[model samples]
Target chain A: MNYTSIECASSTSEQFVPMSPAKTLKVYWLETKFEWLKTIRNPAFALPAILFPVIFYLFFGVLMNHGNVQAASYLLSTYGTFGVMGPALFSFGAALAVERGKGWLDIKEASPMPASAQIISRLIVSMIFSLLIIISLGIIGVFFGGVELSVFQGALLSVILVFGGLPFCLLGLALGMMLKAESAPAIVNVIYLPMAFLSGLWIPITMLPNFLQTFANFLPPYHLSQLALKVMQQDVGDSVFTHLLALTLFAVIFFVFALVAHKRKQN
Target chain B: MQQVNSVKHSDASQVVASIQGLNKSFSNKQALCDVELQIKSNQVLAILGSNGAGKTTLINTLLGRLKIDSGEISIFSSQPGSLAVKQQTGAMLQVASLPETLKIREHIQLFQSYYPNPMDYQKVIAYAGLESLQERFSKKLSGGEKQRLLFALSICGNPKLLFLDEPSVGMDLSARQSLWKAIRDLKNQGTAIVLTTHYLEEADSLADEIVLLKQGAIIQRGTNEQIKACVSSTTIRFTTPSYPIDFNSVAYLISHDVSGKYTAIQTNELNQTLISLLTKYPELEDLSVSRAGLEEAFLELNKDQLAQSKTGKSVINKGEAA
Candidate 1:
């Protein structure tokens, strides 16, 4: 109950001013940096996104398969894409759902920062996770898989999967916006794990039942895996452009769904 | 003659924010009914109400989180959600939270990036009393500590207009004093603040203007003195000596309850009534006087509303308060 307005008045003499509103680029960069720290530090994103793919590769490609270089190289692309998908989906879908549920999203809505900064920040974090997954898998491929590939091919595949992570992120975002926080992880898992298996990240599509193999062509991961395989000169069932087009279409569809869900929430 | 219009008394040169005939509803039950408010720079306006009194709704409406069904709101001459307004405004919402893993300093820094002209971290920490907890993770802090960190984030933007919904609800007495001090400094710096609290004494000490809300309506709005003046009656309670004192014979007595051993009297004339009471019953023991405090005024205004609310379920359309 101290009414010391006089002391505060004297203390308020400093010409303290807020800086100009942050530019869009600065907002994106800062948001990414903090968001990256958040994503990397969270056991939810880090343990599964980085460790799962690396562990899987060690088991199936190294110890189980006895270091078959060609098989190892082929599995690397699919598993890298698989690793990338987990973070992209969970970060946007599950993390966003929880943030929204916790009322953090409402706080940002009142902030001066650009709305798209949230979306872009999540994307950047997911891509960073994708890079980590690819690199971790690459190191594992070299040391354990006895895989040998040119630097250009490895970098190209990494870039491909990194970009390929987006569609799953969009899918996660749509799920996040539509579902409750408690339901998000369950829903993302239902979509993520099944999609990874159906799209042949665990096994080649040709080895599956004919109908399942045919169905794999429709899934974005299948296209992503196909493109990565094509980069390694593996015999993909479809043309490179077909896989690219399929992935692009998936991105567009999921992106639209996420956009619509966001708009709906705003209203 | 007294000038009765609250809006007429507001300084024309210093309107920091205004709401014109704001009306909002959820489904059929109207949550806000034709609410009008004008806030001036450097003034602290407390929105006082009990639970479910639309305090959070008004805050959310001003912050542009909930769309008002009707009426226009302007902050610094711009729309509530517009960039011009948002840049000049900061809010610590009732149910808002921070990222748990981030350290206190990290939380401040993140919110700092949102504003064009944010105060330095040193000023923010000093004012918010967050210096000691700077390195602590947000998840590890006590509820009061978390609230202080949120306050720091709100002020770090150097906002010209600030909205705090029950800012010190969970804080200890010392922490509460620190928060009030920070708020006072911000006010001294010419920040316009809108405060909502159930603590009547908080409103009594800090508010330049108080809006008493009931059932989504502005039942009373004015300065501290003006509000107190609205309820002119005072009460005198005393234990009687079982003597039949004709309380009605006392002039200025509005009403009196005379029982076997007690008498309670209400009147507008305090000094005259006290003199008359002493002359009539010098033996009157345990005498005490009570003025119509803000809590009484609030209860008086919302007596019917409370009765109606308790009889049945209040429509729960405004679920955002959770």
Candidate 2:
């Protein structure tokens, strides 16, 4: 209860000037990567996103050969799309909601870090998990089903699909920014299952009802799977270019919407 | 009167953040109205208010996390949430939820890399009193411990200005005192602090300036001495002897309470009343006269609003609900 206004006055001499945006982003990137490493280090969060798809693929592709069609090749592509979507939606969207609920988003916004870095890092982290799932699914497809593809083909497919999945990952981020953590699982599931089902990831869009076929084409996942299907055959189609453009457009729209929403909620 | 127009000052030393006529709303609800605030360098500006008093809204606006309906905000002479301004600012918001999966130390380390020269991990750990809790995952820590770890993370960046909203919400008294000391230490290092708290005592004891906000407008702003002048009455508490003093005899007496062996009186005339009390009740023991606490001052400032709210017609209360 002693008054020390004099001391308080003298202390304001030293000021901290902020770093440039690029420097701030660089720092944020390393921090986010480290954060991703921390999350993946835990068996609980890391194990499920990585292992669930692998296990599901094994059960459906190898163990249960219910149909006349060779399940290996068919399930490989379908499950690969499923695998990528798992991390993009489950980890990115769900984690976004949970983090927002906890007020971590506020903390990040209040920091010296670049705003774009926060979203980009989370997207990158999600993609990393997606990449792992793709690799696991691809290996299983090769070893079990006798699917013959050169390393170049396999590597090329991985690159294309990973990049193709970016739009979905961004879409999940937008959902996370908009929805509450408790409601995230439900909301994400609403979008996730439909895209997975109607987009030819589980069953080909051609086999679906005429209505769903048209609906699936509008979704990024349909374009993604179509691109993946063509790439696995060592070919790129007109659909690939169209899908990439559509996905990029979707990413931009969602990205801006999420940023604005986040900014609004924060203030 | 030496007028300090908290808004016009441009020198870094004069102000850490300068806000002018800020207005905000949520759908149809007006959350803030003509809110102007000035947070000077190295001073602890405690924003005191009840729940939904636009404390969070004001903080968010300063951080540029939320867009204002109308106003000008300058943090370190840059816009709020600007990278340059943010680099100088560190905040421990009421809503901060740590990533549960990460250990305390790793979180600290990760945040440290975001700043060019963050405080040493050991120092932040020691200051926040989180040495033992550093290895614990954020989710594993208790509420109080989580607050400490977050407090650690906030200071790790060595920010020039720090914002803490309800910083001691989950802390024990001892921890609260220690945290206040740490805040003072930070102030000594030239870090300006703008803290929001419902605990009036914390503000009374720690703040260099206290700005009490009600319905988004500042009801009162001043140092403790300046605020203490707002108290129109003095309080006198004492143990009375067998002779019971009649309340009617004391002209300045505003109110009196008798409980067991003690009698307390609140009065307006301090000197004349004390003289009269000595003459009338020489046996009065343990006598004490003191100015009003922040709680009393706050209640006085807020009495009209509280009364209106009691009548179920408070504008701010209604706005908050909407």
Candidate 3:
């Protein structure tokens, strides 16, 4: 296609000019950058997402555990899972609901911005926040709690917990699409806190009642925390493949819910 | 007026977009019924209507945001909302907002990245008159300033076709004037604009063609003057020391309103009404005669439609009735 001629053309033409790969990448990059900037500047999201897990880890993993390496290591893995979930859920769930209510999403829909750019940007920002949360928890766990871990274990745990946020991001996306802006934060909290506790993110699953531990088998966060614990050799006697399969199934289910909610909204 | 004429004369042959037999309904209520419209390059097409008249629906359908029940919409020779069409189209929809934490410059830059070809950053800023407020976070800006930023974002793509839905709703007088100036500049540069506004004066001053929609139908479509001519009435204003008791009985008088200093009378038969008024009260002073404005024409057209529907009679064009 003659780009200049198309620009100058007065009449409508049938030709479709695809955007270049570099420009497409630039769009995604800019979208992700601004999403990160917006969320970081929001004290409401930034403060809780970074601080809550660190505070919880200091009190539970360090102060309360009394320098027990076993307990500290166990809490570190679970707290890491807990920390990453905050950003993924709140950023996607609450922020998306608020934006949708404000009609900002409509403007984006009407624009040439690819729909995937919006989703991908939020996903990327959630992962970035996940990384921050893991590192913060790691610092508290190592410096204060006397937990010992090799570099390989630390890196593997961080990677697992950080990426494990994907299913939760999808879940948040579903909630954001389904809930009203006014109730999104409270509702996400209603879901987030209880799910975290039941999944053994706050305490080890073995400590929970037997029925509750059985119930944890059905929750995505439980699988995620188990995967993170597997990195530290502290998880229950389940195959890694079982946990992986469970998380994958949960991701597919959440994605399907998000897709359905999105379609319902469009109609 | 000269700009409108020049726009019509220069690039009127190019149809940037068009809709044929468009129909849309929301469940049971018809939102748009067999609508047809042609948007030409360099011309401002004003979709004038009151609330619930399907102006938004038509724009949404053209933007490919809503699917029409049975119709064809072609923009840039492609389906509405297609990437090719979106690449060349810019829209500032009503009641839309921006993320509060992003600075004006960042917002513009991000929106610019969405298009294959975008306007220069400085040019977009200048167009929106945000030279000094580039660093200001959107949360800190006033309502008008936020609207200006939204306008800037819409034009970031340097679109060939632009849709402005009630663009000046919250803008102050000066902000509105600047926006009008920017719109004119874009039109002069050959951008086709679809403006939906209830501000009849805005439509009057900016539109090369006015389309009046009522209850999901086009009641009238013509030039500003032609639409005004539909009412076929002239307004006469004069001040009298004592109010005339029987002014309502004047020949051919359509309506009358008395304010503090002047009593304005609208009549289809201008000469006859003036003669009768003058003969009855020779003291009438400060007399002035002017054609009915677009607002009066719009009200008259809508009123005629309401009367027709009420009476179970086919809608008769008031222009032809006159």
Highest TM-score: give the candidate number: 3
- Judging by DockQ, tell me the better candidate of 1 and 2: 2
**Chain A TM per prediction:** 0.89, 0.84, 0.94
Candidate 1: tens digits of C-alpha lDDT, residues A12-48 = 2222234444455677888888898887677866887
> Residue-wise lDDT of candidate 3 within B1-322, one digit each (tens)?
4334444555543677878788999889999987878887788999988899999989988998887899888787778888889988999987556789999999999999998778999999999999999999999988889889889989999888999988888789998999999999999888889999978889998999898888888878889998887777789998745765487668988777888888898787888998898888878789999988899788878775567576343434632332
What TM-score would chain B receive for each of the candidates shown? 0.82, 0.83, 0.90
Give Cα distance to truth, residue B9, candidate 1, Å: 18
Candidate 3 recovers a fraction of native contacts equal to: 0.58
lDDT of 1 by residue, B265-300 (tens): 878799999999898878889999999887756665
Clashing pairs in 1: A18-B117, A18-B118, A19-B116, A19-B117, A19-B118, A20-B116, A21-B116
Candidate 2 per-residue lDDT, tens place, B1-322, comes to 1113321332334565677788998888888888777777658899988888889888888888888889898766667877667766789987556787788888888778778677888899989998778778877877778788778878988777899998988899888988989998887666789989988888887899988777777777789776666766688889866877877777667667798788877777888788887887788899998888778677766656556465343223221232
Per-residue lDDT of B169 in model 3? 80
lDDT at residue B183 of model 2 (Cα atoms): 93
Regions more than 4 Å wrong, model 3: A1-11, A14-16, B1-12, B238-244, B258-262, B284-287, B304-315, B318-322
CAPRI class assigned to model 1: acceptable
Reference-based lDDT, each prediction: 0.79, 0.75, 0.86
Docking class of 2: acceptable
**Candidate 2's residue-wise lDDT over A1-267, tens digit each?**
222233333223234445666666667678667658766866766887778779987777766764423456666767777778877886668887888887887787677666667667777777788889889988877776566668886887788777777887778878888888888888888888877888877665667899987787688777777777775542224456787787788889878877787666644
